[model samples]
Each structure stands twice: as structure tokens, then as C-alpha cells.
Target: MDESLRAFLEALDYDGEPFGMFYTDQEPPSGFAPKPGPALSMELEQSGAINWQEVWGSFSCVIGSIWLARKKNTAAYFEAARYGCMGGSFYLGFHQPQLDFITHYVSTGIPGTQVHGERYLRSPETVRRFFTEIAPRPAPKRFCVFKPLSQFAPGETPETVTFFGRAEVLSGLVFLASFVTDDFEAVMSPFGAGCSYLTSWPLHYLGQGRLKAVLGGFDPSERKFLKTDEMTFTVPYEMYGRFLERWPDSYLRTDTWQGVRKKIARSRDAWGEQAGQGDGKD
Candidate 1:
């Protein structure tokens, strides 16, 4: 098997169990972009009853090029080709039900799948540059960028924003944006008011979310409402992994982002106060 396939298996933790690797590119190898279906599914031959309570994760690996893989989770693998086969297997990707914490994945295959994820998320522009310059195999010459950078809340440093620390902070926010009925208080608590930084703008087609966009927009019908004029980017997962490599203990909470989150809360508080004062007779 090709190392990409082997490394991909290792990254997925595939234990030689009877499972198939489902693949569908986001864009065509040609000039046309890939119109990813809302869901990518497959049927497995009879193998008992597919376990419905296993883990389903969309992870990116960091091996060769950046890659995205969504592991089909089933405590029990389906039945043989057909024993008493009579069933329907189809569900919305978002509605499929999750067995563990939902984590973001890489759109491109990564070099090291065992530990890291796809490479695209690591350093968006630089990674893209790498693909253009150091790509082992030939690929179409199309590219994407994060919307917030090009436009929206303009007037800042050209290269790096002075405020934001890690781009994945926004990367995490991008993942949260996918939720329709998101709990702002709960979601914002982890990353802070940084949501305001990203939420106000729209998503570009670059970052890691490109592969399984099976769900389309986070809000489904939201494209009609262009909140901001930003390009949706496939997640630069390689950028994300590079971040983790640099900051090994990434799980620790950040006081800086916490402070930023608090400031947003304060701004909201101030806005409420101003609104109340405006209503009173002057």
C-alpha cells in the first residue's frame, strides 16, 4: 500500500478491522471545484449489526500532504453483504449523532496522520505556498483564503492581526460557527468574545472545514445572508498542527483570550446600559 494510505490508516487508528476508507475530493483535480454532497456514505457487507454507539470523528493527519478523514463509527459493523438485509441507511451528516466531542478535521491529507492532522490548517498562506512549491504530486492550481483577512473590519496590519494570538483560536471559532443553535455563553466561554471577531465576518473556502462540508453552511441557508464579504477557506490544518507542535500543552486555558472574552462581555454590558439610559427622559 502507498505510504499515504498506510500513514492515513495509522492516523485513523484503523486496527486492520474490516473497514473501508471513504474518499471524495472537495474540488476536481481539474479546474472545476468539487461540489461535495451533503453526505458521503457507503454500505458495508453484513458483519453482524453495525454498532451505532461508536465514535465518529473528522480528523486531519500530519504526515505527507495535509489530509482529511472522517472515521465512520459503529460499535457493531453492519451485516454481511446480505443475510436478512432489509434496511435503509441514510441520515444527515449533522444529524448522524455523535459518540464523542466533535473535533475539526483537515481538508488535505497530512504527512503524519498518527499524531497530527491535515496540513492545510497549520499555516494557511505558507502552507498553500508549500503546496505550490513543494507538492510531491501534481494538483490543480486553485487556492483559498480566510474571509476575515481580505475584508471585513478592515484597517489593520497586513500580515498578522495585532490582537489575535493563535489563528486556530479563530479556527476553533470556525468550528463553533457550524452549529445552528449555538449556546453563545457556553461556546464563548472557552474561546472568549473572540467569536465576535469571527462571527461578524463570514467564512472563506480555505480552512479545514472544506472536506466534510457535507453540511454546507453551518446554518444551511445562511449563504443568502452574506454577513461579511470574506472568502470561505478550507481549514489550514497543517497550520493548526504546526501550532500544536509549537505549543505541546495546548489544552491549558489562556488568560489572554479570557481577558479578551471578558472585554466583549463588558462591551455588551455597556451597550445595554446605554440602551437603558437612552430610554429614560433626558
Candidate 2:
């Protein structure tokens, strides 16, 4: 992380430093990799019910692993062969045209059967259309790593920077994301998993060379992994750099932000977070 950027966010009383997403061949240190899981496709094909235990061992959501990444200040990565879930494999760019069962799984399951649906959407067709519209891409490398920005090595560049924060912190970031751009849609909230908002959608904008920020963490299924007040904001890494450079000239330094800062302090108190706490409470 740039020292100046760190100072700026600290001044804003942002809870933690933003983390970065990048691709590398290197595996994460032992114990940081997600618990080994069975192939989702095979499990669904054979049992009609997911063995959540074998699928993720101790944690189910990929976002939980990400929270661990931020909390421990270490890298956690996903590979094509070992990505934790079907949704993760798709959103993290390991696969496309995700498992065939996804269409039914997200909506209504097979009629009169034990394959109950999550019912996230009205119908299979709607879920199919959602996937078609988002159009996830394949990853550029074998390993997709999420590391705290401060831990990035020399010459390492992240594809995107993601922040997990409450509404107040996100408000400042949202404005900064748009402060330097004139585009009407500088920030977007799309429908998808928490993991998708953190990586896939931001990568989608990066691929288009657009400096859009993604607001996510609305996925009910993954909410259990996050703090009660947390949501996510992700921008292309280049755009994050622009935020760092322009924030000094933006509204962050003004008295108005000071009011927000007070609110941040109050929130920290309510959440039992202390000032100068390590990174954040995630």
C-alpha cells in the first residue's frame, strides 16, 4: 500500500486497509488454502443434496475465506482444480457456463423432488438470464490470490482493490470513486454472490477498460460470513490509485468529512472496535 494512501484512509477512520486481487502461480502458505472440498458437480449428481461439510470443511462461503485473508493479513488463493464452490469457480474466473445444475439450483428445483432450490430468483430462466448477462470470464493464471494491499510485493500489481466497510466508510469511497469521473454510472450494484461483487464484476469492468466501482455483499447466502454492518466496494486497481492521488484534493480533508469521522468513531464504539486497531475487525 502507498504510505500516502494509508495515511488518507486512516485520517478518514476507515476501518481497514483495502485488499487486492491478483493472479499468480504461487500457492498460499499451508493452512491458508481453503479446506479441501469434493467436486460440487459430482456431489450434486450423486446425492441430490450438497454435503456442505465435504464441500468446505469448516466454512462454506468463499467470502469467509476472504475475511480470513483480510483478518490474518495473509494471502488466500483459489485454483481451477481447488476453487471451493461452483459459484466461486465461476465468479473467480476458473470456469464459465457454470455447472448445469446452477440454473435449477438458484431458482426452483426439480418438481416434487428433494432437490429444493435456494429460490434466489423467480425461475430458472431468470437465473439463466442473469448468468448470461454477467458473462464471467476465465482467470488469467492458475491461482487467484487475495492479499492485503500492504502485503503486495515489489512488482506485484492487483487487478482490483476491495474494501469491506459499513455505510459511512462506503459513502466516502463511493464519492471518491466518482469524484474524478464524469460517467453517469461510475458505481454499480449488480445482483450476484458476495464473491462476484468482490472480484468478478470488478474484473468485468477492468476488462472493458472502464473505471467503474462495484458495490456488493448483498448476497443473503454469504451474509453470515461478514460483520453485521459490512458491505463491499471494489474498483479496478488503476482506479484505486487514482482515488489515492485525488483524495487530498477531494472532500476527504474538509470539515464535512470530519463529521463523518465522528460517526465512524461512534460506530467503532458501538461495535467494540478501538481506535488504531489492526487493519479492521473482519
Candidate 3:
């Protein structure tokens, strides 16, 4: 539950459903490393006037539909995946400055089913369609929002964080990063589980460049609560164990959100830049 994301939603007037959540920038008194982020106080500058939105997989059409796979509703899944791929997943051909990005949680509605996994995997085509289709070529919105929430903050409390957006959906970000440098491996899985799906098409075939994924997984028991359509996103544990052993100071940088936001906002210049709109404009 990244506070910036929560604040961004409220600022965006997502007040209809009034989704409620309890969050603390600090972990519980018990022994848990919390998620991988920095301290909340260091997370953002808290300009108080800053405005941003966490628009991960809000392409509801493709999303909620994936849950229908269990109902033999692959059509709904494909439709949703198509829209999300062409829409939510990519940010190309824009003139905005780089924007913000980070792993965060949202208490989004669940459609129910396992195809959410498929949707996550097959997202690029639709992601690029938006840049190719929909137009007037709207100006990119201001405010860069990223996530990975810990417990701590004024008016923030404790509650289980439900990961709303699916995983690996941000492969677009990974692909875009390839254009600038070879740090693509910075986000790849050690076992290569996602590499093929990651590089299956031109979406990621940037010709040259790579990133190192500090990727790791958790154990099933460590998973708080997961239903039939749910997955714990676990790993062998040994991989991350090495990460902690080597760099004992990377527990989710709450403090880095603002900086991360600015960076993505800058990168937007290359991906989602809107030629005439000024970054400072409303």
C-alpha cells in the first residue's frame, strides 16, 4: 500500500467505491522485513501539492475478464488481454518527460479465475495498440506514480495489502529501459521463467541491452492469504537470501518513490511524450 498511490487515487477523485485500506510505513512489531522498499519518510518529499496516479492495469476490459477463464470464458480473457496489451502495458511515442514507476498494491476488484496469469503473460500487442490507435493523441497526464508500500505514515494503519495489479505486466518498462542501456537484467528472473515470454517478440527485442533482475520468490506458507484464483508469487527463497546476505539494506525504498517518479516522468519524453503539453501544465 504505497501512500503516494493511495494519495494519487484520492487526488484523482476515485471516491466512488471508497476502497478502504490500513497501511503503516513501518512493519509490525513482529519480525517481517516488510516489502522491499525504503523508509516512508524517505519515500517521497510529500510536497503536499504534488499530484500523480498509479495507472497500472486499470484497463478493466481486459483485466476482470481474465477471471472468466475458469468459466471457459477464454473469449473474455482474450478480449481483456488484447485491450490491456494495446493499452495499459506500453508507453511509447510520447513526448512527456520520464515518469514515475515502482511496484505497488491496489485493492482492485477481482473477476475470479486463473487467466489473470495468462493476461499478465500476453500483454504487449494490446499495450502498443494505444500508441498506434486512439488519438487526438491526447497529452500525457502530469504526475508520475509508483509503489511498494510498507506500514507507516500519518492517518495510516495496519491491514493486509492486497496486490491488485497483476505481475510482469510492466515488461513494457523493461523493454523501454533496453533502449537506454543494458541494465535490462536488473529485473529478469534468475531461473529464466519469464525470459522467453519476456523476449518472445519485438516488444522486447531492442537489438541490444539487458537488465539484471534482483528477482526472488517467497514460500507458500509465507503467503498471507490466497484463494483458488490466487498465487503466492513465491521463489525458492535461496535467491533472495543471497540478496539480503549481500545487500542487507534494500527493504523496499519508501523514500525513493518521489525520485523514481521523477525518473519515469523523464523517460516519458521518449515513450509517451505529448508534443505540445508542458510537463508543468495542468
Residues 75-157 of candidate 3: C-alpha lDDT, one tens digit per residue: 22111112222222222112211112111111111246322222322334432332233221121232111112332345543
Error of 2 at 258 (Å): 0.6
Clash count, predicted structure 2? 0
- Model 3 lDDT, residue 46, Cα: 46
Top-scoring candidate (lDDT): 2
Of the two candidates 1 and 2, the one with more favorable TM-score, higher being better, is 2
Q: Candidate 2 overall Cα lDDT vs. reference?
A: 0.79
Q: Give residue 209's error in model 1 in angstroms.
A: 21
* TM-score of every model versus the real structure: 0.19, 0.89, 0.20
What's the TM for model 3?
0.20
Model 1, stretches more than 4 Å misplaced?
1-233, 244-254, 264-282
Q: Where's the lowest-lDDT run of ten residues in candidate 1? A: 61-70
Clashes (backbone N, CA, C under 3 Å), per candidate, total 65, 0, 58
Q: Any residue pairs clashing in model 2, and if so which?
A: none
Assess each prediction's global lDDT (C-alpha) against the native. Answer: 0.23, 0.79, 0.25
Residue 206 lDDT in model 1? Answer: 22
lDDT by residue for model 2 (223-279), tens = 877787788899888788788778888888899999998998888888888865634
Q: Residue 107 error for model 3, in Å?
A: 38
